[model samples]
Target: MILKTYRWSFVVTALGLVLAAWYGLSAHLGIGQAIALVLILSILEISLSFDNAVVNATILERMSDFWRKIFLSVGIIIAVFGMRLVFPIVLVSVTAGLGPIEVIRLALEGGDPETPGTYGYELHEAHPTIASFGGMFLLMLFLNFIFGEKEHHWLGPIERALEKVGKLDYVQVIVAGAVLLVVAETFATEHGRTVLASGLAGIVTYLLVNGLGELFNVEDHVEHEDPATTSAGTTASGVNGPSGAARATGKAAFFLFLYLEVLDASFSFDGVIGAFAITSDPVIIAIGLGVGAMYIRSMTVHLVEEGTLAQYPYLENGALWAIGALAVILLLSIEVEIPEVVTGLIGLAFIVASLISSIRYNRAHPEEAHVEQHHAAQPG
Candidate 1:
């Protein structure tokens, strides 16, 4: 099953390596050095985005098969080309006050990254705003998740307390707003207004997407339930079957898809900037990171299809915590430079700890394990 799921990823990896080799040969970077850099960048992307796959799986599993397919296909295109390539160019263009064509020309010229006029330099200059926006969006996601009531609690005491606090109205929003305000004042005094505005945009974007998703979801529930046969038919059509149990579809699915893409964009901000540290070559960076993204997509589908999230319930919690850590790191990084390795390792640590906890929980509660396995075994 693993091999089957990762077949396309393998193919993409091979193709990416081939492209890297060609670029290396043409650019006189040496085939081995170029291939190695691509491998390094790919590893970097995977390490930074491992938690992303887990979070994506949580939402992807709740989507219908058709939309899931769309995520892997259409979503991957947007992720690879849009986020990794065009998005950076757009950022450089907007920040440098250059046209898109001019930005493309500058990127192709590929001067020293430290030089003020270079493509890498401009992108780096835009990092504050990028970090502010992505950080706030991710913070909102983390806050919303932790603040929600859940039957399972990985970090029991802390989660319980947060859940209690979550009962208060708009607690997540208030907390996020406060954090943004502090970050703007303390860390980003020079660019305070820009940071605040970007952060607010992030908050508003999250609320809009999440609100629309919920609104459509309620409509879906209403449409699924027949007023005349609310009890029997509602269960049959909306609560019991494979398609039931909080799965997203139609307009709800579209919003979820939008959320996923934006979530992906936020996650990619760090990777895109960090890629320059390895090499300033945009083509190589794209090939390498794009290959890693393919693997992430495969991993997400594998987790969903294998019901890994269901089998290891705490995994999602761990991923969310990792996201919270990343959000903090991003916000902090606006003032202080945080290493990419630090971010990756922190997230990896959380995921590993959570996986171990999940295993211990399963061992301690075999009945619950059996029930999860039974549900997973059922056809979807």
Candidate 2:
């Protein structure tokens, strides 16, 4: 089962390493150094994106198989070539007011990241806006998750309290707006307006994507019906066939797919920028990060197929908290230089703790474990 799930990841790793070797041999760096750099970058990306896989699994489980296939195929292309490679160049071009061709030339002519007019330098200069936009988007995701109701809870006291407060209307928006205001007023005083605008854009993007998903979702409108009927993909409530309440389909699935892609982009913002610290070569960065992204996609699919989220109920909660931590770190990074290792470690800590907690829960509630396992064994 494991081999079946990760077969494509292995294929991607092999291809990425070969490409990394070619780029290294073609460039000034030796093949050995290039391969080493790619490996390190790949590990860095995987470590930082573990929580991303969990969150993605949670969403992907609700999507139809067709959309899931699109995610693995078309979505991987966007994540690799688009976000990891082209997006950085585009960002630099816009921020430095240079043409895309010029930006590509500058990137190929890599120099010291500390030096002016270099690709790394220009990308670094755009970090504030990137942080603001990505930070706010991730913050909104974390906020909405915590402020919304859930059947299970991890960090029970805190989550319960937040859920109680969430009974109030638009609490998530109010809190997110307040945070943006504070960030703009204090930490981003120099580029306050820019930061504010970027943050607002992030918030709006989230609302648009999430709102569209909810608007198109048919499950909410399905009336309460017999469990047997619902399980058979026919609700007595008159919602017929497989689209009844089992999975998102049609326009609803598309928006959820969009939301997942945007979430992936938000997660990648920091990884792309931090890649420069390890190597300034764009080719190596893309090869390495692209390899890592493929594995994350595989992991998401594995988690969904195995029903890992159902088996370990608190996993999603932990991932959301880690996202909240990351969002805070991104916002704080605007004023203070938080190390990428620090960000990665903080997220890993949350995941590890949650896994241990899940184990304990399963031990104490063996019957619940049996129930979850039975459900997991059933098809979506």
Candidate 3:
């Protein structure tokens, strides 16, 4: 029955294709060519993103079943609408002086709406700005992944320090705000503006969502933690879960989703640029890439439900390191001429090698195979 339910993956794949076709129809792409493009892009995206799904599963498996379901449903909306749709429009708005409606039209048309001379000129025109935004974005990701702090901050020393400074809380807030403003004012470059606006948007979004979460205290999907399973399993307090394992897992899944979104955006950066390299038509690009995004999502859920990551832990780590490498490539692309398809191939090679290694590792580590079977058989 679990596997039967998971078969909804096919339905999702179908839905994505349908949407891509619709976009193609609106844009006047020939139906046959549109279908072919969608299929190719979908396969490419899915193959490239298999590692991402494994990484996600490693975290999502720990969430409560209810929360996992909610993640599958609601998170898809955020991925499709927020990242796939709204994000591109934001890029257009920031770089092209176009309002959202016109931006939507441009994307639907895949930039083919304008005359060849004008559309091609505008796209080339926006390349510098797009490259700038993408470059900084990828650099931040690389640094954060390779060098950023990874410690858990649940009531950590920083929080303790904040508590101690409660007497001067207003002063602390003011100082932090002033420091940020000064940095933004001092830079005053396009890159600087991008960083400020994006970072502030992120912080505001987090605060708003967190405030609501606390207000609602939605605990219906919280799971019982298991200590034997996780490092943080014994340390969590409150209704955090039984052993802290579940809570830690849920938290990790939330962040992992964020990381995947970032990676997806990065991948899209190159794909979008490269699509224009092929043709300036925005419809073909949308249909192709939209279908591609769908397949990636489906593969992610499949890898999770099938426990692929657990069956191959080294593969999971390898995929992460590969992602780190790709982050570097994306940042480098801001100034350099690395091909997006080449970057994709390298990432995919890492995942495929890892998959092979996982198969070999599982052959040697028979106990892991048994454990996965046991877990797979457990009732939700």
Q: Over the full model, what C-alpha lDDT does candidate 3 score relative to the true structure?
A: 0.51
Residue-level lDDT tens digits of model 2 in 99-210: 9999999999988789999999999998988999999999998988888777678899998999899889888889999999999998889879878988999999988888
Tell me each candidate's TM-score. 0.93, 0.93, 0.65
Clashing pairs in 3: 110-281, 110-282, 110-283, 225-242, 233-243
Tens-digit per-residue lDDT, 52-171, candidate 1:
999888777667788888998899899999999999999889878899999998887777789989998999989989999999999999988888866579999999999899899999
lDDT of each: 0.84, 0.85, 0.51
Alpha-carbon error at 263 in model 2, in Å?
A: 0.3
Ranking according to TM-score, highest score first: 2, 1, 3
Output the better candidate (2/3) by TM-score: 2
Over 4 Å off, model 2: 219-245
Cα error, residue 41 of model 2, in Å, equals 0.5
